[model samples]
Target chain A: MGTRAAGQVGRSGPVAWMALPALVFFLVFGVVPLFGVLVLSFTQWDGIGAINPAGLSNWRSVLSDPGLPHALWVTFEIMILSWLVQTPLSLLLGVFLAGRQRYRAFLAVLYFVPLLLSSAAIAITYKALLDPNFGLGAGLNIGFLTQDWLGKDNLALGVVIFVVSWQFIPFHSLIYQGGVRQIPTTMYEAASIDGAGRLRQFFSITVPQLKYTIITSSTLMVVGSLTFFDLIFVLTAGGPGDATRVLALDMYKRGFQANLMGPASVIAVLLVLIGLALALILRRLGGSTTASQQEGA
Target chain B: MAVATSAQATSRREAPGTSYGRKLLRLNWLGGTAGWLWLVIVIVPIYWIVITSFKDQSAFFAQNPFALPAEPTLANYQLVIESDFPRYFLNSVIITAGTIIPAVAIAFMAAYAIIRGAGSKFLAGVNGLFLMGLAIPLQATIIPVYLLIIKMHLYDSLLAIILPSIAFSIPLSVLVLTNFIRDVPKELFESMRVDGATEWGMLRSLALPLTRPALVTVSIYNGLGVWNGFLLPLILTQSPDKRPLPLALWTFQGQYSVNVPAVLASVVLTTLPIVVLYAIGRRQLLSGLTAGFSR
Candidate 1:
């Protein structure tokens, strides 16, 4: 028995040894850099010259900064608007296509086009489309819709949110469609035999089965929208009086544009904390739902 | 299941104008019509961009964007090509390919290790460590990364872009690959070990071949992410010669503000490769993303 146990240990030894390089890389590059950023958040540094030792000053400044509050509000606004618009639209589209296999393939391709294009390219195309004069925005006589899509305080953030939603709706649709496809046909047949309407069956069967996918997709959306920077950066550079400046954009401006490494690190650390909080919330929600599902089973 | 299949078969074999048949046909028609409408709506903006790229300067300015260009000309394409666009394309290709190969290979090894030792605490810690990459927003670290690049004398070089791209890709690649490897049955690995297969032999001969689908998905994901990346290239490479296509498009926008046709032409050229790639891998890519939902 001792020999057998020893053999088992020996068999597993090589596997653990093989994981060493990956562990070392993760430690030095991933964990250390993150810890470095957290440490730097407490110090004052201009990204050059000697780093002045400051204690909690950078964090205090970030907490009190007006831009932080404004950026947080815009971030949440964009996240909420994106989720609200994209989720329902994607579900409708997913359901619409679920019954038909032939043309669904074609429609899926079409919907995924925007996702293939680079954010820079998309921003440029939309910029041209939204050009206030002598562009698609003007030609369509929807100048109101086009009016400073990138430059206006009221419309810039909304436009960014719309663009993000448009790009990701297909992604959400794909998830929803996958979930919808997994529902056993017998349930639908039973519902129809009972004279239930399509909407009624949908609410009773479709949405409940899709709970996990919904949670997963929404988690992704929240994290993605919160950390969104590339599209907004290219589209407006957080213009029109910082109206569209989400937290990521604000962090970029602080660190890269303004070269305030210290405060930028603070914002970054905060963003990480926000992501962690959301993830924790999601875990709790996911765990309870899964437990309840198992209990029901 | 057999009864349902036979029922479906009988319905398929039924006459065209019967109640059930007509209902099915009508459902098909409704689905088809909505699908076509969605296709049209989604394709219009892309159509607009492509059409605008072909228009001459005057036609570009005078005509409606939704309408086709009158007297299509290749002058805009020619003009962009004659400029520094070629150099930017080369830079983009080099950086993307350079980053993807090493990142995928390293990630593959890491994923294999983690998968083979399912509940090992050290591997779990390593996995968690990689997840930290997801949280470190690029905006926060751009400053330090920039300083680090400059201090290392790698600024404005292809290395700057490649390093950060590869670094960021590790987490996602590791995530996807770990999931993929986890799905590989442990029996295969155990049999290989029983046969006295070396670790390298098992990875090269067994695991790598079985993970082809996952590899393809990961490659497409990595390719898209790297190819479309703009921020690192923007800050790291100031030399126009070193800039990639996205930055090149930005340059085109700035340089030829009045030459709108030329600007649109550059955008078309920049987006074409990725569009073609997506068209090829659309099914696999969508499946991969949805696969994440299942996990």
Candidate 2:
């Protein structure tokens, strides 16, 4: 593209300095801190105190700590459970919304309300609503609704997953909705003419065609779940015996709350690695041979 | 001629008012059930939040949790307002605007440069860096960001939050804006160049207007993010005067732990600005978000 311009216009195009401000800002704050997190992991700083070299001590302590594995498992559990709960519902809702119905549009507006609220606000709202004794269930005298939703281990984890899904499903569905609309109507017409029922067409056409979108949404869900700090911090504070302590929350607790910046940086590094790995895995899933075969078909 | 005719036939067959539109709208009981069922799940909590905000503290404990407040009062809202709510709201407004204006301006410039200077190795490398920046969960770098802010004498100030936010907002803003700018016809830029327009001139006149929707999308998206941001404020600032709405909401919840009505009222108060923004920009925000991600 630039060759065409250079040949005709007899000069170079836009100056590179136009991009310098943004590049410098990102490098200083984004790229530098990324490496800084790594560097800080090897040093001892009490978040506000004089820095001192700790070498591999931080790594040894964090690695040997059983809490590290438990936090990893908790993070993985929430990521997987939220993905499982959100994907199918988002796909179906996205397809239903692709139809140009006024009511569906209205429904979408209401559906997106959750996306507007801060995770802090949402967590707080649920905290009040889930109080076992004075909460909605207890007030209504409903036996099942009055359980200690955030007081027990399994139930606390379940409540976190449910709240996370409730907060995010609308956004993913919007992505899937956009994906659904982009699918050509001609394909659906052809399938209808072949006498395929709606369900068969959905399975054969809709699901297969949404392969990339599924990957995109899932990647966002999985990677984004790693940073579910504010919500869990407010909701559980990693309580009920540290049942809901994910890595990001773990980092916060270790660094800010406990003033263990060195060990916290180690956890932060692990989070970055895991997020990158999961994203790459999902991208590979999206670009697999089966997807290519479907495209060819 | 045959290819053109077949294309026309396909277009006619699939045009609106045809069976094609009706066929696609064929009822799916499962989707409908799921949609309506999910609507209930989404709406109930919100409904409860609004109605519960109106009840007085005593009435809250006495009434059914989901019932209408028999003696609704403004005391909750009153209590929330008298407790530094206005200062937090102002801080949020400043931080959001402060982060967004500079972030979007620089991002637009970068996006313009990257698109217009399409073959420049430096610009391409810069673009690639921004793209990779997308994959990084920048939140993980908060410890260092805190250090950077402290060393810069910025800790415990609104600027502490604003600077890093502008940096974080750049990657997505640049990506989305470049995608939009890349769609501008090259012939348009060429014609502008023929008229002796400089790159700056072309950016202001051609790319800027053409990409206004993208700019709005980026600004609103990043704005909402900075508005609702908790981790930065929680980590960076310690003063009560520096608290943003999310962190303010957190502390307020703690202080008023048993005063459910007051806490709920604060939640409603903090969220009202965004809900109003949503009501106004519903179409642009929704459509822009869909296009931005799916593209």
Candidate 3:
């Protein structure tokens, strides 16, 4: 590859040669497969049967399927729950840790434990703890507390939402912490001097300063919600009669287990579309805050 | 209390409604308590798993759930080790290396090219492609990947898992590595060119050594994801012998569903290697991650 640029190596020439392998990999793996998915989406194909053109039928079936609506509802439920729970917790911890001088490093590392563990590992730990028969909760004789968390139809998804938020809070916290650290301490000092209490100063200063980070982290959470599969897959396997059957899990079930490739691709495309739309909205919202803040300053 | 700084004491004694200018001067007990509580929540499950790994089945049932093992035994661990744990571990090692090495290597080149060839339309297009790759979730792509692997006759092999994992990881690696490479001063490249260094020579001598930490960071970051991956292994590979640790643990549960101690012991064994690596090399890994935000 470098041979082409051996004698006539312009500024871009060698660089292009260096980039060739990576470009090829993405083209083959990333770009081509994406197109393959799109083409495959419009065709009805079981893994073994002759592929037949769907003529909009696959899209129609996927959209019209009763499961789709329920899964969508459940997915959004998890999203809203995670956002509501994960955001405040991450921000609180992030802001507190950034402002403190003591045990900051120790606490950050400790909090980061769940982030590093595989989702599977975390699922197993929780499953063990929430075990109906002899789990930690049950073993401890907390009658009201223990309720077959994973096995029940009503509680399984809530437990999943809690666990997923727990696992991801640290990641979002680090982002928020960085944003908080960048805010000038002088701003807080001035606010305090102006008769603003800690609560008042937090709203007036910390929230405004962290606008962009909040948007970024929120977009990530939204996307995480859209594509959540591992925890659901690991713990309950979307069980107790579709109590936790999320879109990603639905896609997996349809594609792999049920062998419905077209519908699965439809689900995938829908997920990507939702993710893009949300990201764009967040970016616009985040950008406006920066502009407004600049004017205020 | 006697050793408290004047600023800390003053801030604490300041009236509740009246604000104090001294910030970070006093411990915010409310926030401190909240932070400590969150830490306990995060660590307790891990503590339970680790402690439970040592207890025998009877001890695990008889003793308190969070209690230390009264008659700690290595029997569960031994049973797991004898039951194909080594094979599963080896498979994971091979798969992780297969994914990370190529993904990071190719990404380095691409990042280098993107930085040095900044003005080129093609390079810019490549950069955009990697960005697009970031938004594509793994769930949507699995059906196609499964079909492609079957088409290529690579299904159920470690190669199958490795290929798609590398594809998914390259976008982030390229993004991070490109940011790092752009920070390498232009003068370094200019000086190298003046010495008649070819692009290959320049990359070997200058770029590789400079971005070495990013390389390690990308490798470990992607390696860990692949190591813990469940979806790909669950769908792509079918053989019990070929399953990685996560899948192995999942299957281990099914086989030993009655034996809770053994299942947790297997989980502990699966996670131990990464935990050790994290404990030792955390600062370097996290700093590399933290550096990404500055850009």
Model 2 Cα lDDT, one tens digit per residue, A1-297: 744635756344455788999999999999999999999999999988898999999999999999999999999999999999999889999988887999999999999999899999999999999999778898889999999999999999999999998999998889889989988988878766654457667888989888878877887788889889899999999988899999999999999989999999999999989988887787677666654322211
TM-score of each candidate? 0.89, 0.93, 0.91
Which structure is stronger by lDDT: 1 or 3?
3
lDDT of 1 by residue, A1-297 (tens): 222333676544666676665555455445556677888888887765777778998889899999899999988888889989887777767766566567576777778777777888878777777788766777777746557667778788778877887678877788777667767899889755544445556677777777777776777787778767778887888888889888888887888778788998888887877876775676567676484331111
Considering the true interface contacts (CA pairs under 8 Å between chains A and B), give the fraction that model 1 also has: 0.36
Candidate 1 residue lDDT tens string, B1-295: 6567556645554452364445545655654575566667567778888898899978877887777887999999999999978889999999999988887888888888777766677777777767656544544556556666777799999989887677777877888787778777777877787787876789899889988778877888888878888888887878888999988887788788777778888988988888787778777887776664555
Taking all chains together, the TM-score of candidate 3 against the true structure is: 0.91
Candidate 2 deviant stretches above 4 angstroms:
A2-14, A288-297, B1-27
Worst 10 residues of 1 chain A by lDDT: A288-297
Pick the lDDT winner. Answer: 2
Q: What tens-digit string does per-residue lDDT give for candidate 2 at B147-260?
A: 999999999999999999999999989988988898899899888887888889999999999999989989988998899999999999999999999999999999999999
Stretches of candidate 1 off by over 4 Å are A1-9, A141-146, A288-297, B1-37, B131-139
Estimate every model's Cα lDDT from 0 to 1.
0.76, 0.89, 0.80
Clashing pairs in 2: none
Residue B72 lDDT, candidate 1, scale 0-100: 93
